[model samples]
Target: MISTRLQDAINEQINKEFFSAYLYLSMGQYFESKFLRGIAHWFYVQYKEELKHAEKFISFLNEKGGRVILNGIPAPKVEWNGALDAFNEAYNHEKFITSSIEDIMKIAVEENDFSTQNLLNWFLDEQVEEEAQTLEIVKKLELVGEHGQALYMLDRELAQRQG
Candidate 1:
């Protein structure tokens, strides 16, 4: 049986994952409004991936015989200065998520929940990739600043991203 504390923490994480999906979906719409279809597509993929993350947590909770209590997701920002601004937010959010997972990992360790620790280890590695990917885009956007042609090429490159 899952401890109440760990169950509560996982429930909170599930809400956060859902919020992330909503945030990315909002960003996708923002990019679409700016006519940056490729960038929008990238955010759309991010949205889907976040939904999957939430579902993964839900599955884990079920497997552990824990109750899944969902909370409301606050609305995400609908505007950004540009792709760079959006990606910077993304990078920061990933950092926040990493911290959250670490907190949960700490609780798991305290409780001696080896299975939860193993699950969180996967998320920890995934967070590294998530942060790296967003940071890379931020750097590329920095280089492509105010350069329409360069941004266009980058958009084309991003369009090739599959899911």
Candidate 2:
């Protein structure tokens, strides 16, 4: 069985993951409004991935004999200065998520909860990929600044992303 502290932490993470999904979906809508279909598609995929992450946490908590308690998700920002600004926010959000996962891992270690530690190990690796992917987009957007053609090309490349 999971400890109350760990259960609470996982529940909080599930909410954050859901918020991440909402944020990405909002970003996708922003891109769609800007007529950047490819970029919007990319954010759509991110939204799906975040939803899956939340589900994964829910399943894990259930498997550990813990109750799942969901909370309300706050509204995400609906506007950005540009693609670069949006991607920068995404990168920063990923960093924040990475830190959150690390905090859970630390708790698991302190409590000698091997199962939770093992689960968090996967999240730690996933967070690395998440941060790296967003940071790469931020860098690419930086390079394409004020270059409509370059931004369009990058959008095309990003649209090719699957799942």
lDDT of 1 at 3: 99
lDDT of 1 by residue, 1-163 (tens): 8999999999999999999999999999998998888999999999999999999999999999999999999999999998899999999999999999999999999999999999999999999999998899999989878367988887777787788
Estimate the TM-score of every prediction.
0.98, 0.98
Task: Write candidate 2's Cα lDDT for 1-163 as tens digits.
Answer: 9999999999999999999999999999999998899999999999999999999999999999999999999999999998899999999999999898899988999999999999999998999999898899888777767366988898898899899
Q: Local distance difference test, per candidate?
A: 0.93, 0.93
Off by over 4 Å in 2: none
Checking candidate 1 for backbone clashes, the offending pairs are: none
Candidate 2 vs. true structure, TM-score: 0.98
Q: What is the lDDT of candidate 1?
A: 0.93
Error of 2 at 64 (Å): 0.5
Task: Point out the worst 10-residue segment of candidate 1 by lDDT.
Answer: 143-152
